[model samples]
Target chain A: MTDESDGNPIERTGDEPPDGAPPGGGQRDRGDPGASDRELAADGGLSAGAETDSEPRIAFYGGKWASTIPLAFFILWAIFQSGVLGIGDTNGLVIGALVGTILGMFFARGDWKTYADTIFEGMTQRVAATAIVAWLWAGMFADTLQVGGFVEGLIFAADALNVGAATFPAAAFVLCGLLATGIGTGYGATIAFVTLFFPAGVLIGANPVLLFAAILSGAVFGDNLAPVSDTTIVSAVTQDADIGGVVASRFKYAIAAAIPAFVAYLIMGSMLSGASLEGSAALRETATALGLVHLLSMGVVIATAIAGRHIVEAISWGLVVAVAFNLVFGLSSVSDILVFTVTEAGAFTSLPFVAVGETASVGGSLYSGATGFFPLIVLTLLIVSMAQIMIRGGGFAAIQEFLLNSVATNVRRAELTMVLGTATINGMITINTAAEIAIAPYIARIGEKFNINGYRRANILDANTSALGYIFPWAGGVLVGYQVMVGPEGLGAEYGPEMVVNPIEVVPYVFHGWFLVIVFLIAAVTGFGREYIPDRTSEEVSRA
Target chain B: MSRFDKFFAGLSFRGSTPDYDPGDVIEVMVTGEEGGEVVARIGDSTLRIEDAPADAVNTRVLVAIDTWDEAGHRGTGTYRETVGKSAF
Candidate 1:
């Protein structure tokens, strides 16, 4: 446990078959593309003809510890700049990563061409590709729901039920949790609820930050439990668990955590009541029929997803149903759902987050929802590439070895170590799915050593990953959600920076995220929901 | 660290691994022979059967931990019944 990392990495060789290359083998440099194509008769993708992939070549950053310098620096910088200073800017992280990688290049021992090729190779790893594709589908479905006036249905429900000002936050938690679960994307839930629910909750008299916390908590709940969630998919795939098995098995933990979270929201909502809404009751007498119909659209997603459809297929169905419902019910105009027009000069003219132009037309909800994750997908790719570099250089292995030796001495401790280690890493990376992918191999390896059930490992990996990613102010989920809270369009117009809920203020209030961490830790230490690997596993259950 | 966490900690599921009390019966499968020690898969993990014939390999058997090391993975088990091949 106390040993400093020192190990020889496997070198790629010509005799090795592609599958024989090793774990994360596809991440190795493909070599010179053109010449290799002719030599090996391979498609000449990454490092084909010239060199067998199993051969260990010179590392870009000299060796394992040196290669890790850039990533270590990024984590440290992230902690100081975001964790301490409270700045949650992704651009800053991008610059930090870029500069850190460039610094590694300066100290690298390999040829410049080899370093560049290796970077390209790392960028194309299959693990990153899988998560990014899932994100694209999830983002599209989430945005489509918003465009179809799903939030309006919730507002109508709130009015119809005569939800009091003191109870709105708790109600918002449950409703948003359901929406996020059906959609399987936290950012979507955050944007929709923060935009639609926050202002309405405020107009009806609720503490702004408490309301914001409830919304974030709901997103965490949905993201954790939703079978279609990207984190769920990544955890299952990376750990080789069945998706349905992971969802069903993890459901107990999520509910265990959610029970306390809901009650906390209720207690907080009552205790933290805001100014009275004297005239708010008369603002809108009747809820729109169109708004109410979108509830059926949500039901379609939840039902289809639970019935075992593939996440991409399920989301596609949800998107179609939502679009159909929107049009049939006349909930929103065609332009609202699929507009391609420039913003008019008025309240929308000063849209802070949206990039609309007078000459060039911009898209509406559907387009915005799908494309919103482009930057994140790009970031995810770069980070995965950077992780690949660490892998090839032996940095990742060194960290794994340290953890395996120092922390995981037995089955009980190993599971506990995995849960805590996953939570700690997620807090550093601040993107739940990426963090899940990064630490997944460790979870798989450690769990397998003890023959822990694949489902249990996936559950632990995802529970912590999803929980920590949303609790922190700097987490991508929180930041994306916060952007909606402060943007100068729609809800943002009503609440400027002054009224915007400070992420720090909402952190403790994110009851579900905190409770989830607690639940997983307790589960880890006590073996709650822990299932050992059976001879006949649930591979079919996952695909189901 | 708090009383709340302490209360919850006691509520977990007996640590996934079976609580190996004496006189308890369980199923295991013969997995391998390491050196002179015979290994069997029980509780979803492998353990050495203390006294089992080489012919017992790849067959199902009933056993209990002869000596359990909760902190270390390796342990020896005492065979209770030599069952046939795995049914699954």
Candidate 2:
């Protein structure tokens, strides 16, 4: 086969046989094949029969391989730095990101200018836009609610449930799940619930690990299914499905898994409720004080979100409402609110003298608000740039072509492939938004080929990815959970182990994650409750 | 060329192509880095394909495909691809 004029080997221009072609040739015409082969070749094609070739298949330490190589190293360094390896603790991810970016340039394959452009693009669009937006809006809302005592209100609500000690953890689990769904962030939910509910659960004689697991489960549930969740949006948009359809289709599967998990937590809570703490009244009073001032913020966020507003717009409104509540409810003076919002602990202290472990001053607060997302923002940029690089490098086309061809033969296998593929991407990225972006094209393609309903595909992809992310210890969700576990009043003493539930320990207790997987698998096999396949011919008419 | 031929020629074979009903059994060849050959039954309109790591010698696997007909009927026929890639 001669290479084509466009430098593409096996490139097909027309779909017809050559004139005067012999019958029964069973061979593709010169211009019959698509652009798959050439694309693959450019992307470091798999060894054809493994003959020895010194062509230097993109080395990790080299410039052409910088993105993948440095990313891997950064993850490893972060794992170690975050005390995942039980060695001396350091900021592994932070250091890894810094060193990795610098080292990446050395191994990049293109010219200095191209590499610089790629890096800048990676930092700005992927990292800055997505991660910064997520952190800023989420952080602003979280901080606003904190000042308004939203967490305290939730605590008071939980206490008022007056459930038996045996069922308290389960109740907490449900409450946390609802809170996460309402807030549209698993990490925020994990932090808030763990701070409030974990300590309360421990004080109330519940198994600390179990309690922690409940919180984690709730986080996964909300992350997997919430309409406003970044994961949900990414999944739906990427799959080309509407948000309502995605949520509705996913509801059956999510609930199936969640109900059993909820029951199991109740059972476990009953078995584990034996610990007791004194001064319940004092804790109640504190919770009540916080609760009385913050009730409206939750309502504002929920109402705005349910009104079908854009996420940013909804969150902005929520923030304004929270600020208003702070004033109207007399929760904090305007000055105090301003100071809390703007100041961090370090700024108020003397500049010349070192103060140990002080709260952030107003300037520090502003700085953190601005820069706390820098690392995530940078990582997001790198990953997106890497994705673009991969696409440009032809890796995406190669994989996509292969998937489409394979999916054409079967439907069941196609569904499973979408589920597993989404999960794998989520596992690697540990961020649902990134994972959805990376995998949505493939999922949508495969689903469409089988004529699978968009809603079903979106639900399965998002739910599985969301569920699996929190189960991986390296996942952001797990990391947040671990941070909560290690806090002063976490599960450390009660569980007799460090507060951080090893990813392994938490996996078994991540009932929602496990349940979601099983439910998806069952739905795939049983074909129960599958929705009608959309008719493309009718979409316009229906919409009109 | 006939209208159908022109249509097929212009059709995108990417993810946006409309779905087809591939009767009781459908055969597909996975071509790419992890290329392989597999056949599966179409139970619904969707199909899932799984490709392992490049080093894993196993051929790509076809796990499931939705064969459910639009009328919720289960039977044989080559369903036409209606929705095009442009919709996505």
Candidate 3:
């Protein structure tokens, strides 16, 4: 085994330098008694011969470069295969994966012997671990809360507000945003609210496109700032900051943009107010009854997260508390809740089961709660793994070093680089969670250089990634929202594909996303909310 | 030997010593192959020396480095490494 040491030469750990340091500090001169002119000139004039005259350039088209070729090829292939070029929509991810792998081979500079080992190293690194654990725990917590009636409670609460039909869109935006933040899964929030709140808004005569856009906007808001969010986790880890530090710093910036976008939604809602529908009374009563039972679930998540517990432990406690609430309130039987947890939306088969020789009918609450997140869980795993591959292959590093060397000159430029880099990655991948992980290291590195606070970096990283994820047509969040609007028994009759605010169409209505981008840019230029920034001292990063 | 060589050779021997004056602002121009150029500033240091990347640049204006105290605990200090003209 190679001897590993920490960054300090004094603290020897076997032999390897700490995480980021090069082992043995590269080649050292053994027997140089005098400071010869050639030696001094070659070694950048350092007596110890520790420094080199020229900066080490990453040899392009090397083994690292080879690994990333496949990903690029896959993107191009996916565009063609998905009929995104007009043929027919194929599985773009599959195409991307296949192409990315093939390209990896050609760009690989080293011989075949080390290829497998390098790939393995890339996959098993700490970077992958952060994304995997954060996503899974957040997924489980989101799922459990949904099965525990969190959405029903929210809907019930919304109903009781007696919010006008015209104003429902704005209210839905805020409600969805809150739900996404609490649950830490924007896609899951999108699906749940789109099914529950969007339908309700439509029944009450709210514009379907406007209502859906509001839901999408809220999902973006929560996804961008939630402490438990996968994007946030990736951003913090990559940037070498603690999750708490990241969240605390980003809060002001997120709120700055969110508040204004919210007001605009309200104004638009009022201007668009027209007709009314029936069933406000039932919706209100049902919501009020369920609201009290489930409110504690959100509280548990926020409180434990703030307390700085490990994410998995925090969410586990949240799940337990939610389940306990279900039991205490007699809201639903344990069996019913368990069944609802695993069922998917839009699938049903009535089954008769004999319990103690008594025939009981079982109906699937397939569209009910948490089960909706199963697909997202799978997607997160694949995307994160892909990100791991990218990182290990050195593509991520290549991009990061490029950004650091170019663009990240001062504090303001560094911030802009963070925002633009995160947004660009999100737009290309159409997956915010994965994009956040991919871009996080650069954000942290650049932020650290300028002593830009950790929170500011995290906020920019998360918000930009979240915003761009929904702006792209193929992004998971947009797809879910679009599906909800066009599904059978959906608002298709009133607003078909042409009118149903496709992800591209919703970009104009995605006031929150645009607002966030603008706000972040403004902050970057003006340094408006720079006070809360945390200097990512090396100690903090190593511990992190 | 040239003055530049003598100075750098001396600074290299004192591994952790500050080579640059405190609060001296130096401009570092980092050129990339394809990306373009990036320039940064270094703030101040307590040590004395000249022309080394670490000495010429400002630590406060650049990246922060985490260091270890004598007790083997972690502490943060300004980073000293500065890239000149070419940073690949």
Candidate 4:
């Protein structure tokens, strides 16, 4: 790791500060709409201590790096709460961030107004807003597909294909990967698959541990490649690349790893079936082919997104297609898609999507999908705000300068730093998207210094995030999958103690995740799939 | 690029230090000022940009490569016009 003890080497002249500084130190420039820390510092009318011609950089008691106190404290909190305690509560993370930001204020050299104003400034960034909008839309579309019986459809397909115990793990991997890719949330996919496919695969004689690994491998695949995935969105937006181009550019890496992972699953599935159960044909009675039609919805989103339509437009179209399919095919009812219920029946209650129920509440796939991301959205904004504080305090510049001047002296080392930096951060944080966001600015700075294109930078950032997120025992994906196995509503209720797969046992067998990391390591060293900034430019990032 | 072509793009091995030929026009984000001259660092390759705008750092500009030294992976270019601004 590069040392932060040194001061920022990027000297700020009296004429102009860096990208995120006020155009003129302490100048209140309302017309400049730059979204970085500069826009915030400039647009925020608060006078930063004495309003001098020189750059009004906020200094900490120790140095510029001390300005990183808030983010550093939050990282430590995340390490303890998610890594050590293994509690992946985003709300708890939000509290940690709030405390960190507040704590950082005491260390500022001058007026606290600049530090406080930086919070509001950071929160208003387009990067954070873009990610939140993408997540909400993706969540709604994914939930709609899930509610439409996508998992059941996969089960039906597996059954129809007559995938025996010897092939179940491989089949499960492919099917679960497709579901996760469509839904864009590996955690949701893990829970759903563990609840349905895990038991089914086990009862059909597939090895429990290998089956679990297959599920996680599939999730890694989707998390890395899916256009609508939160990690994908963060990687793309933070690196200033379009979601469609990012997805398309990353397909090669995902597929290269997936092929070998699928083969390993097939070979291991057959050899590890020594503990196979007697029942081979037992399957969920609800499995049906009609649910498979959601494939078209997923295809529409991917196609439209890759064709350069706006992400909001693409996902909105996908949501429309999914809702239509659910209605026409009777996959789900109108009330299931969206429902507003009241305690008492009224004239409006007769509306197709409204109902009278015991409690007054809104329910349905759309509601749940959007609501699920609420905590993450809050966490993202807070983290970005914290990051902005670092930028203003020169902590960010100090670290970047240190890395560029010392460790990442050449293009090769720069690429490697990007890969390893992302990997190390993701290894500690349970939530991959959160980790990706925290490290994104560093990756962007390092990559752009050498003119590494947005797509390559985004690919490197996301590959590690997606890979490590499912590999470690404390990872959010593994914990969610484990929770499903042990929960009363899941496999533990029906299959009892023997069905649960220990999280540690599945780590080595997560073939896709490991392969993805390996692919990136090789790519970084070999310059495979690398693109210079002038090599290409993606479509403009459309703010939602 | 077409949607289909995007998936196949970047399939080959790129070099850490790429090469540029004279008269090759390209758009690049000016990385920074070095020795009071605008420079664009593309991978390990460096191009000294001549006649660039004063505020060229972090801004995208079109340039015509005038001279290139393959051994050192360095080149000189004449700045054309600013094409874009930084993204945050």
Top-DockQ candidate index = 4
List model 2 lDDT by residue over A372-476, tens digit each: 445555555555555444333234444655554454335556677777787776765555555565566567555544445556667778888888767766677
Segments of candidate 4 deviating more than 4 angstroms:
A1-56, A274-283
- TM-score for candidate 2 (chain B): 0.22
Residue-wise C-alpha lDDT for candidate 1, range A1-544, written one tens digit per residue:
1111111101110111222222334443467332222122111122221243343433543445666766777777777767777666666766667776777677566465655666787787666676777677777667766766677777788888988778888899899888888778877788778766777787788888888888888888888877668888787766655565566667678889988998997898889868443445433443454665666666776566555566667667877887787677776556666654554555554443344556657676677776877766776666666665565555655565565556765567788889898999998876677667667767765665454656778888888888888888888778777778666564446544434777878878989999998988877777777765432243433232
lDDT of 3 by residue, A234-314 (tens): 766665456655565566667778888888888888776434444544444445456456557767876666555666676
RMSD to truth, every model: 10.1, 11.8, 12.4, 5.4
lDDT of 2: 0.53
Off by over 4 Å in 1: A1-62, A276-289, A339-358, A489-498, A540-544, B1-45, B48-88
Ranking of models by TM-score: 4, 1, 3, 2
How far does residue A143 in candidate 4 sit from its true spot (Å)?
1.1
After TM-score superposition, the amount by which residue A397's alpha carbon in candidate 1 deviates from its true location, in angstroms, is 1.4
What total of clashing residue pairs does each candidate reach?
A: 15, 51, 24, 1
Off by over 4 Å in 2: A1-116, A119-135, A241-245, A273-281, A289-296, A299-303, A335-337, A340-372, A401-409, A428-437, A451-454, A487-503, A528-544, B1-88
On the 0 to 100 scale, the lDDT of residue A317 in model 3 is: 81
Off by over 4 Å in 3: A1-67, A77-95, A273-288, A337-401, A488-501, A531-544, B1-88
TM-scores for all candidates: the values are 0.76, 0.68, 0.70, 0.90
- Would candidate 1 be rated incorrect, acceptable, medium or high by CAPRI criteria? incorrect
